[model samples]
Target: MEFNILNQSPVLNGHSVEQSLGHTTELAKLADRLGYKRYFVSEHHNMENVIGTSPEVLVTHLLNQTKNINVGAGGVMLSHHNPFHVAEQFQLISHLAPGRVNLGVGKAPGGTPLATAALQHELRSDIDSFNDRFLSLKSFVDGTHDNHKVLKISVDTESSKPDLFLLGGSLSSAKFAADNEVNYIFAHFIKNDENLLKEVASAYKELYPGGKFIAALSVLLTETEKEKKAAKEENSVYSLKFKDGRTLRVTTEKQVNDYIKNTDEKIEVEKSQLDMILGTKDEILSKLNELSNSCPIDEFMFHLPTADAALRNLTIETLAPIHTIHKEKAGIL
Candidate 1:
């Protein structure tokens, strides 16, 4: 089974931003030494706890800091930026890393409404929707913008194009990826809809033969039974804290405005679900095998939810030697 680390540059125990970023850099190096396949960080904005606001910038940082290890974005929220621009950014990243950069695009707004508004100025009603924008992004990256050939976008690199992965929680997105001949990641951690995951995996197989289907889940590798229980307890929050730094899933207008008005406002969101692989070595491996049998996914990406620095390092150290996906990937998850 292929294992990858999904990071969000989390700020543990309210550490300074510099420390959090430095810690993330160290983790990237650790992943490189561990033999994990990829180290992909998600893009988030206006969150005190998570410092990763830009994936392209972070990808560049990871590439510079690590010698080997695929470095890429778990996803770039494509809706916020221009498609050509996104393609161009990855173009540089792909050439810099050469066969290690990935451009995973997702439809969901990666931030609150306020943040999205900041990103998306001059909205166009007649412009592109998520599907349209994604198609354009694909075209730009592939250098196949369907217009005058004189105006086609090119990567200006001899290396291969960044492997494009569509991140989603629905079957429609799976079909979109398959139809477009791109990679697909079923983000079960976002929403643990088992039925949807099965359907998407099945649809991907039927839609595109030999396509890559990834199962990305939240995971926490604990050292002891006591640690496992504590990890679960720490993550088992009953309410959402998006308005504050406790969470980052706030998307509604009211919530975003409230957050903007008072960054410390304690707003609550309904139904905060937690789906993770939190257990010992044998248990994690066994659960991974079970998930493999349960779905037709081709790869597995593990997203860590903890901000505890020691625990995080322990998880990586514990899993690195035994659960390394490749002899060397040094790049991304």
Candidate 2:
């Protein structure tokens, strides 16, 4: 029942890069102070709305700002990078932060098709091949080079590799993560399917031999009515982007219906319902309790709303109690 923070450092509206970084760092610092378990940032490319393109750089900056909180990429887009290079870069970061790093990786290309192509360049491959490369990268991390011809990762520095978490919004990722024996983090917000989340987690657990699987949920919590409306508007549109690249905003029930009328894709109401963990503290906590009771989620990564430093700080303050409840339930303290 442990809960941590996962952020995309969203550049909402037309926020500058500096503003996004400042806001993210402030949130990380707040998370560290609030006794939240860890704070992870995501990776995206050419998404003007998101500033989390370089998780490597983000992790480095976050580590500098926070003392106790574990910071790493909620994932590096593994479908893009050379496995060997990714392994080395992560190993280096692990050395810098030691035990305070979590190396989460994802198979998603992460962004529009053009952006994906640019980021992946010639490294793109089918899901199977991409997963095979992930396995190769993991082997390198474990210091097992028993069968290698030329290319390999060996860090001269006196530091261990960070703990690995496989991130996904799909069942394929769950199966791959389980087979590879790494922890899994389901991107529930993007996937918008609670049943699928459970199914994936169940599959991972059934395949894994007593391993960890985390069901990371993205949430937007607020106190006041105005704040709540703003959050809903933000989340509704953000959720719509996953469908295709629709620009229409959807907040109210009517707006959601209207958006549906404009698009060919049927609106995933059940999945969208899963994203509305937005409300007062008690209301959101109750929802989380229900989620934990149904899903075998070990950790919950709360992706707080980030407009700027003030809003981000307000979110952490308001959401701190929920995180505490999760920690207490897990006996973390």
Candidate 3:
């Protein structure tokens, strides 16, 4: 199976934003040298801990730092930006890295309602508008829009468009992605229902047989019981469903409490462990193999949830494609 990385650039306690971003750059470089297929960064805003606000900017920096690995947004939240501008930005990045660029888009706001409002202050960002925005972005990127006759996304005729990916976990999202004939990545870390994953995968595959279907999972490789216990605690996430159909996901109970205190809306709280593969290197690989056997996942992208730099690096090195191949050849896998 192919392996890719989805970095959140988490800023742990006492770690500066610069340090976190630098570590991300180093990890991307490591993944590139290790024969990983792609290294994508996430988009989050208004969060003190997780700070990957601008995926396009990070993608450009990572592309300049790495050689062969495909780099792009794990996603750019389409709800917060203009489709035309999004297409143009990624297309320009594609010119810099050619086939090594990817553009993953998602329907979520990627932040709190406050941040969303701030980001979309000048745009119509209703939830129902995501489909239209995505279609416009796709058309612009593919050079199929009728307006292309009068305007172009990129002035460079030789520039290649980035490969497009839609990030979602629901069956409806699967259908949408299939209908659009774009790559689909199921966010298993967010909602870890295996049967649902299978159904979504089957749905997408039946409709778009040739499209890529990836599963992004939260994972950490641990060496001791202490680390394993801590990793497990960090693997939990709280999902709050508000009365008005707004959902908020946070990692800590403190954040959940803060949200409840700040909002007057009634919410149903559901706390679940993130579907993370946590164990030694061998055990982790075994779980991945079992998951692959059960689900029709075309690629596996690891989302290291820990803020510990050493553990993150170790996880990346342990799961590197080259290292995995070496172990397989040695009959140690």
Write the residue-wise lDDT of candidate 1 on 257-308 in tens digits: 5555754455666545476788887788778778778778787887787888
Give all candidate RMSDs, comma-separated.
5.3, 5.5, 2.2
Clashes of 1: 13
Name the regions of candidate 3 deviating beyond 4 angstroms: 125-128, 157-159, 242-246, 260-266, 325-333
Sort order, lDDT high to low: 3, 1, 2
How much is the lDDT of residue 255 in candidate 3?
73
Top TM-score prediction, candidate number: 3
Candidate structures ordered by TM-score, highest first: 3, 1, 2
Write candidate 3's Cα lDDT for 1-333 as tens digits. 689999989995467988888998999999999989989998998776898999999999999999999998989998888889999999999998899999999877666656866887886435446788899999999888988877788887355779999998789888999999999999988887888988998889999999999999888998789988888887778898866454667888887786676556687889987777888888988988887888777899999888889888889988888889546757886
Error of 2 at 182 (Å): 0.6
Question: Against the unseen true structure, what C-alpha lDDT does each candidate score?
Answer: 0.77, 0.72, 0.86
How does model 2 score by TM-score? 0.81
Candidate 2 per-residue lDDT, tens place, 1-333, comes to 566888888774455878767878888888888878889998877555677888999998899889998898888988788777888887888778889888899866565456665765675355446677788778777766555445446535345778888887778778888887888888776666789988987888889846677766656666789987776665544244435332222334554454455446544553243365777767777888898888677778887654545666665776784455756667884
Off by over 4 Å in 2: 12-15, 122-128, 145-152, 156-159, 224-226, 238-274, 305-309, 321-323, 326-333
- Decoy 3 TM-score against native: 0.93
Overlapping backbone residue pairs in candidate 2 total: 0
